[model samples]
Target: MHFIHTNKSFLLISALIMAGLILQACGASPETTPQETPLAVQTELAGTEVSIVTHSFPASAISAQEARLSTIVMGTITMLDVNEGDRVSRGQVIARINDNQIRAQLMQIQAAKMQAAAGYELAAAAFRRITNLYEQESATRHELDEATAGYNMAKAQLEMLEASEQEVQEMLAYTVIRAPFEGVVSRKFMRAGDLAAPGQPVVTLSSPGLLKIRAHLPENLIRELTAGETIRYSVPAAGIEMDSVPLTRVNSSGDQMSRQFSAEAVLPDAHESGIRPGMFATLHLSISDEPAIFVPQSALVHRGQLTGLYAVTESGQAVLRWVRTGRAHEGRVEIVSGLRSGERYISVLDTPVRQGQRVSL
Candidate 1:
């Protein structure tokens, strides 16, 4: 009990015990040999695959037959029978302008025509009387001449009035607007009661069934396209792709200002697929088909401004090799340079690694 109560003795005993533990740890050896397992990773051989390089240009779907429905006669729009998106047949009445003034003018012409006809009839009777009298030697030559001149003048006047009447009637026909072809109304600019003038459009009608793709190709690539050749196109918004669309037209004579030429392709199934005019489209012109090497995008490492990928050496070590990359497609990037065909490169990694680390396939 006295030995246990002494504080200096307890501290001295604790220090001696710690010193013995340290010495024993120093003298002991590992029971089983300590070993390092190689880091497991997957590897693949780099090789050339067929790569499709294309020059794509933005395009639009347009109606092959489009028209702006307008009236030649100026008047107030009295009737607009169709709205936007309304389907119309060829020669269908679309809109009408108030032709009350035209009708009034026509009535005035008709009255003048009647008066001229009455005068012509009277002149004809007088000329016939003069002819009979002159044949029977009962009239003077001067009187007959005067009667003949009056008949000719009256006949001319009557014919002139008839022409005027016809002119007014034709102008009346121009007040009614009609569709030139079967199509849908894309826009209605002048509604009912709106003032309409000549050359101003009342509605925009397009032949939706005759839809085609129109694109402006740059001058550099215009030589590669030709008429009657089938090309591939896509409507990204509609998720539609066409591979065998027949090219209807291509103009290599590039525009002077824009330095581009126009191209058009027939869309045979555009109506069925709900592709309408003014919808966006893309035209794909295949540039080349050659073997190009590609690397997995996941394996690319970016250290500041430099990009590198891990490659395996013959001695089974990971060496970080800097690579110049091109465009990325799908899940892989194009190896423009710094990598060769049939070379070994690291793929997806499970654990982070460093340069000179051992990798086992």
Candidate 2:
């Protein structure tokens, strides 16, 4: 029984070996081996392009015509007819100071003027009477001279008082503050019942549509600016971009303290857009133009403070190399060093690319 069991085991092993040999000889199944999978990546050639190097200097929207409303007289603000953001026309009253004192003075002057008029009338009548007496030889020469001096003094006194009265009236007019032009009330520095001084502003009136982009740039940048040159600008808050807008003014002479000149560009028409004064704006001024190699920003691998991108080799391998970058325009960045022209670099890395990973173009 043991010998029979051994023969049965040997027969089973022999049958399995013969089947494997027959399958190999007949080519029923081909040999299989493992292969390395290459990763798919997108690449672009690093070449020179006409890169218009633009600089973004901070800018603000400012009203071209702005006025600070106030009165020459120092007194308590009696009436404030408008608040901030109120629309007003030219010559419209915006605020009034305490004009009671001025008005009272005007009345007192008017009374004095009337008295001076009466005195002048009396002097004129007396002069005429004295002249008739002298002509008829009934008055002495000394008496006629005395009347002439007296009449002249009276006439001068009357004129003096009348001039004082007109001066007081002009002071009364200064108590009322009015808008200088058609504009909106932007700020209120003093409220009703507040003591207002000659220089202290009561309200600020600013023309809304008359806005310009004001930028304080360095001397180097101001040299490249020119009037009537179309450029690009954007209102950051409103997300509005206006291209082809001409630069209306460029001032090379800055204030003594600032040492930075100002340049202006016309703001977009307020009627067509929601751009307003005081909104933040960014002006892209093209300071220079040169041919340079650039790559997309997405390909940059930022590790701590260093920036790097994957460069594809001719041997179908991705090698991550550190590079020095320069000014960036839109989504592309300038490669200043570490990458040469005509070299292939990854522009868009949607996968987790490594330092020495194999990649397929």
Candidate 3:
């Protein structure tokens, strides 16, 4: 019994020593304060103010006077003087058809006319001589009559030949094609040796003096547009924009398929702006004058499919707030939703931030 009690006491003392060692090791271990490093960041307050509410619609630049030049004669093209993009003057010869056959026919008619003229001259001389002989009773009446008939026939033939030559001359003139107005050739449909039929377009010409924007707007929006309303035109691809262009006209009829109405705006300073036809443009329409929230573009962060900004909470914690964005202007973007005016956002940060991360302004 004494041995068993001694063993129990030793076991109890060993257990106490192990517990004391465990406590000492735990006390000596490093402790974490659960603190996060503060991030240096720049913050901005979202703004809301009455601004122009404009809607952009696709459009294209067009000339006031555009034409397609066509051929008037059916023949093979012999000479093409001007190509696409060539500047031409009024009545300038731009193309010519093969006139060899017409020229040859004209020469033949002229030769025939000369022959007829000589025959008529001889016939007239013989008729006069025969009439004189008959009056003198030296020639028979039948002979004089026959000579008069021959003279009349020769004169008729000569007149017919002259008419034929005139017809040929007119045809020769038709072989040459000339520009009807002074403009730049926009396109060419035919080249040398190509067959050009009557009424077939050879080239397209556009006058650059007057320019306009052609756009199609929804039927509901057309009612708000007026003839002289001021608007804006922009070409995103060309990096150009013009303000205060007056609306020229609007079509009353709506397209059955597109449900859109066509509209036109004349550019008063097109020449000074160096605008050309066929360039794609955008037309901006002022729809309303309501206040909207706007934020700097640098504040936006895209994650997965969510577009949002890094906002600062009341406790100075960074929170990712998803937002709906509208059109962008300059360096600022319109915030449609999820972000309110007067709220602060981290516009710039030294290091990347996370949700619930502490940030210092």
Candidate 4:
């Protein structure tokens, strides 16, 4: 009975060793196999509606005509009738200079004229007497000739004095500076007690009705804008609003330094709205027309120097497409390439997505 029990115990031990070998052959170690990773899912997004459009280079506002007022005659400025930003009319007095010297000279010329007139009268009386004497044969022919020469010289002297007086009067008028045209005085260059000289500026004025914008544009853009074409302008600082003003002129020649052509646009009643001369402005111009696709700025994704969008393929695959972009407006960006209209894009996606990976919509 003891020998039978020992054989049974050996058989049990052998069976247990065989079972352990089978478990190792099956590769059941926990360290060998990794845990399963979660798959990323992408959501379908409706593409933004885009419109075909054109764009152009921006422009700045400039003065169409700026005149610097100067004195035509030299004298001390005694009175200034207008201040800066004061409206003036044509022929209105803007300033006055001291005219005491000119007035005194005019008076002196008047006195000389009076003396010459008396001399002329006396000469005429003497000539008439000489004529009577010659007619009666009481005067020699030489004497009559002498009397005629004296009379003519006296008359010439009177005429010279009269011319001198007129000249003095005209010079005196120059002391009063008058507005050349109806405009607002944009600047005051001189003050009372200041000496004004010929060609020296006293005030600078601008015509409100003739207001316009001047800009320099690149040569390539010159062909895009033309005379009579309308453009828009705005002044945020001055709170002025304008639109569709006709372009008045364009210089075909480009600037030597900037290689840009000069352009101008006429503003309609800009002065009435307090749009002062020399105010800065912006100009918009259309340059060209080209076809392109666009998307909202919100749909863009950034990945370290790569700007792209999440796209969902027709077969429900996640794709990260790189794209080129153009101008942006109202939160929409132009997709110059790499996108098409009416295509489905993935705006939102589950984290850890990869390209060509199947994703649940």
Candidate 5:
């Protein structure tokens, strides 16, 4: 017709210019000044007072005499002479054993004790010449009883080879191992050709000159423990701290399947506190302070296994709180429950926020 009515008026003016650019992009309005600016963060006002109320537990650092050492015979180690931390003392030999078959059976029992002291010195010179010829009557009472039975069988074969050369010199001093005290050789377990036997061990020692923490405590905190009181230990994995520590052993039996109670403590300068033995420690104890909550471990917030903190709410927003931590002192962290002290939280984040995220001061 007129070219199909002028192409249907150019398709109705390109569909009204795409609906007026979709209503001018739906009345435009999204620039939100950098997400409504607010994320400033870094707070902390979780108060609550009355401090002390301690009660820690989980201790360890023992060694009020460790030991181990072993080897009472059954040779072949041949001179190891102390090593693993070596300190040794009480007779300090430390290791030896291969005494060439106890020095060749102590040189064949000292050559049979020098042939039984030359046959007991020729049987005491023929029993003093047959008792001086039977007091001058010229011997023979059967030759003075056959020279007194050959001088009492050569003086009982030289006293049974001098008691078999003093039991082969005490089995050659059990091939020397020594050190039954002074300690510090934490552990060696045979090395110089290693063969050792009789009870195995070979070295472990310890004795940080009397240290001790040991803990277990729970028969309701062993009735507030005593033995000399003092308390407050800590080992934060060996950074060790002591402060009064004293409680020395409180065991009156209780562990019938861990009702607990096996205390210890005693750190009297733990031999200059190099600590030692097992290690872990904690202790503390005090008890009646109350009002807890604290916080600040950078306001926590771990999520995947929950341990939280972004809390800010009251409309400032942030909110992630899940809390429930305790006893981290100094850098703060006791919260013990879903947080409630003063409440603001969100300690110092510098960016990654989210849950209702708004944050500011």
Candidate 6:
């Protein structure tokens, strides 16, 4: 009976083992099963509207007119009427030097001028009287000639004194510096009590009406620029951005050292927008017109040392494409090469993607 019991147990254990193997082969646990992600749907992508002909180059800002203010005469500065950033009109008094000595000299000149006038009058009368006497034969010829000569000498002395007085008056005027034009004062080099010397700058002013941007261009590119050609410019410091009016002047000649041509563009007053002289600016020169593929900046992806885009294929698969980029503007980047028009691209993907990986639009 015991042997019979052992045989039944063996049969039961064998049957249990076979049943377990069958179940394992027929079913899989959640952890062992491969997960399948939902396939992404393909959709039509909107075409990006980009400029057909665009060129970008390095640029710089320069003043259209710059003037250095200087004192015309040497004197101790007594008063300064304008400070830096002060607006001044043409012929407005900007500053004054201590002209007490000058004024005293002017007064002496004026007194001398009066004395000269009196002497001239006396000489004229004496000459007239001597001529009458000679005509009446009441005076000898030698006496009349001596009187005439004396009168002429007095007249010459008076003329010389008058000229000297006028010169002194002009010199006095130079003690008070005046604005040469209507402009804003950009600098103040001298203050009250400071000694001002001739040809030394005391202030700097620039015209408020005239403005331009100056930049140096490569010698090879100089031939492409011409007067009256419009370009784009930006001034970040002044928050100015506008399509610059045509270049009013172009120095076609290149610099001997840098071999760069000097160019200038005139800016309209309407576009000034608080831009001041010496503000930084940039210029975008137009070289040629050509068709190019472009993409929005949002679609770009950087991986290591490469820049590319995740392009969706017709089969709804993400294809990472390496691309060559060019000038960028207004959130759009130029695809110089490695891209074509009418191709759909993924601007924003939902999750991490790989090459040839299935994706949805």
Highest-scoring model, TM-score: 2
Better of 4 and 5 by TM-score: 4
lDDT of 3 at 228: 84
The window of 10 residues in a row where model 6 has the poorest summed lDDT is 41-50
Model 4 spans with C-alpha error above 4 angstroms? 1-67, 99-172, 208-210, 214-220, 238-242, 251-262, 271-280, 289-300, 309-353, 358-361
Q: What lDDT score goes with residue 254 in model 2?
A: 88
Error of 3 at 80 (Å): 0.6
lDDT for position 333 in model 1: 87
Better of 3 and 6 by lDDT: 3
- The residue-by-residue lDDT of candidate 2 on 328-356, one tens digit each, is 88889888897999999888989998777
Per-candidate TM-scores read 0.64, 0.66, 0.50, 0.58, 0.32, 0.59
Stretches of candidate 1 above 4 Å error? 1-53, 251-255, 287-361
Instruction: Give one digit per residue, the lDDT tens place, for model 6 in 135-204.
Output: 9999889988888887888888888888887887888888888888888897889898899999998898
Give the 10-residue window scoring lowest on summed lDDT in candidate 3. Answer: 235-244
CA lDDT, candidate 6, residue 39: 55
Sorted by lDDT, highest first, which candidate order results? 1, 3, 2, 5, 6, 4
Flag clash pairs in model 6.
40-359, 40-360, 41-360
Question: C-alpha displacement of 359 in model 6, angstroms?
Answer: 31
| Runs with alpha carbons beyond 4 Å of true place in candidate 6 | 1-66, 218-224, 252-261, 270-272, 288-361
Best by lDDT: 1
Q: By TM-score, highest first, what's the ranking?
A: 2, 1, 6, 4, 3, 5
Q: Candidate 3: where is the Cα deviation over 4 Å?
A: 1-53, 101-171, 253-256, 287-361
CA lDDT of every candidate: 0.88, 0.86, 0.87, 0.77, 0.78, 0.77
Candidate 1 local lDDT, 1-361, one digit each (tens)? 7867798798999999999999999999969976656678888899987766677889999999899888888999998979899999999999889999999999999999999999999999999999999999999999999999999999999999999999998999999888988999999897899999989999999988888998998887777778887788998766786555878999857789999999999898788887878899998877545578888888888899999888998888889889999877668888888778888989776678788888888
Residue 139, model 2: lDDT of 98
State the lDDT of candidate 3 residue by residue for 1-361, as single tens digits.
9999999999999999999999999889698898777888999988885666678899998888888877666899988878777889999998899988889999999999999999999999999999999999999989998999999999999999999999989889989888888899988999989998989998888887888989999987887888888888886555585566888999999899999999998877675676788888999898655578878788889878889888898899999999999877667788999988789999865568988898888
